[model samples]
Target: MSLEVKNLVKKYGDKTVVNDLSFTMDKPGVYALLGTNGAGKTTSIRSILGMLAFESGEILWNGGKLDTSKINVGYLAEERGLYPKYTLMDQLLYFAKLKGVSKEEAKKRIKDWAEKLQVTEYIYPPAVKGKKAKVKKAEELSKGNQQKIQLMAALISDPELLVLDEPLSGLDPVNADLFKNIIKEEVAKGKYIIMSSHQMATIEEFCEDLTIIDKGNVVLQGNLNEIKKSYGRVNLCVKVEGDIENLIKEADLTVVNKTPNEYQLKVNKEEDAKVLLEKILQTNLPLIKFELREPTLHEIFVEKVGNVHEE
Candidate 1:
């Protein structure tokens, strides 16, 4: 399934959450949606999922409006909603059934996912304190485990499209790795994924295309690498021994942050780096290190958000 959101708008009284947002994604690939808190990320997701009625917009499954009454879509919210009183297997099978999966198929898929996620041991609820919770009613598991259940709820049905919101919210590094590998495998199988996250490292590692919104407006969108390159205004930090200030100065770089012995140069036009490097070598400055680095996602975030915070 494909998603096409066009002219989306949402408001609460005087406050507009999503302002005429639009985007199109087809085929199987990971798409990351990023924005600061209260920047309409959630609103947009909700609108597309048919959870909220937008003032005016279009959400299409393939090329037409989404048939909320018929589309088989799965959603995993950041705030997970799992019955703590239900056994993991029972809960998952319930969701599977809701998605129209047969009992046999749901059972097989649940067992397969449990093993894949290394949570087969958690199939039965653990004892929290003194009382023993029955199979029909159990409430003992870690928050991370609950998140895993949420992931399974959204993924077990094997829907054509998966909408995961902060899917790794509670996972540690190891679990995060496992989750990413699973997401990758799903992608390889040609399942379209739309992920919302604040973790830039995760976004960098997992997503190919991304859309960044600020103040209810999209400031950047497209392939991650291409966006980084085209966004320009990138500063490359070079650490080489000796004085190459004159050469760097000759490069006429902007946003030049420097110390006596080290130099950080911002190349608005990256082509100038080549000319700058040639000048540095001519000066016989000890070229101990010469590298070009893209701006960190944090930097990009601040630029988009327009609020600098202490690092």
Candidate 2:
């Protein structure tokens, strides 16, 4: 299913959370929605899910108007909601039932997901310990495990679109990879996903398309690589002491940004870096590192929203 949000506006008294925001997402790939906290990412997701009312705008699924009755979507919020005392299986099955899956079907899917996540061992009580045969509580598991369950729950219904907010928050390296791999599998099965995350590394690695909002407005939106290229600069990482600072001070390039040990410099459109390289070598400084590449999603985020405070 394709989603189109046209001139969406959401206000809270004198404050605006979403300000005439608009974007389109089609099926078959992952799209990342990136922004700092309180930038209206959550508010937009709730509007899509029909959980809140907006002052003005149109939300359409496919070519028609978007309505809950016309499509089913799965959402994983940043703050995941789960009953702490409910066993994983029981809780998942209950949710499955709400989605119209039969009890037997829900049980089977739960088993399959448990096996995929390698959490089958925790599904049942320990017979040797004579632990009462009851479902383990959600809080009983680690935060990573809870995140995994939340992801599984979002995918269990096999909805057309999966909305995941900070889906990788609590995962360690291994499990984060596992979760991403699962998302890839789902994409292969033709599921479209909209993921909101603060982890730029993950977004750059996984998302092909993205939209960035700042101060309740979109500052950048498009294909991930395309947007990065648009930031367009021959990025050089340098680690020399003397004269390096002076080179930055009197260079024909725009210093995109800098750190104590390194800096990002943006030259004019397609400006040749050969001149910059020659100048660096002549600086009587031993260069520890230097490379030319485009800015990343993270860099773009900081550049676009560095000083934009919430109104």
Best by TM-score: 2
How accurate locally, in lDDT, is each candidate? 0.79, 0.80
Instruction: Give the CA lDDT, 0 to 100, for residue 249 in model 1.
Output: 64
Which pairs, if any, clash in model 2? none
| Reference-based lDDT, residue 310, model 2 | 32
> lDDT per residue, candidate 2, 265-296, as tens digits?
77665444667667888866777777777877
Stretches > 4 Å off in candidate 2: 129-134, 240-243, 250-261, 269-272, 282-286, 307-311
- How many Å off is the CA of 114 in candidate 2? 0.7
Task: Give me candidate 2's TM-score against the actual structure.
Answer: 0.89
The residue pairs that clash in candidate 1, if any, are: none
Error of 1 at 243 (Å): 7.6
Q: Candidate 1, residues 80-162: lDDT per residue as tens digits?
A: 78887777788888999888889999888888887888777677545668778445322577777777777888888787778
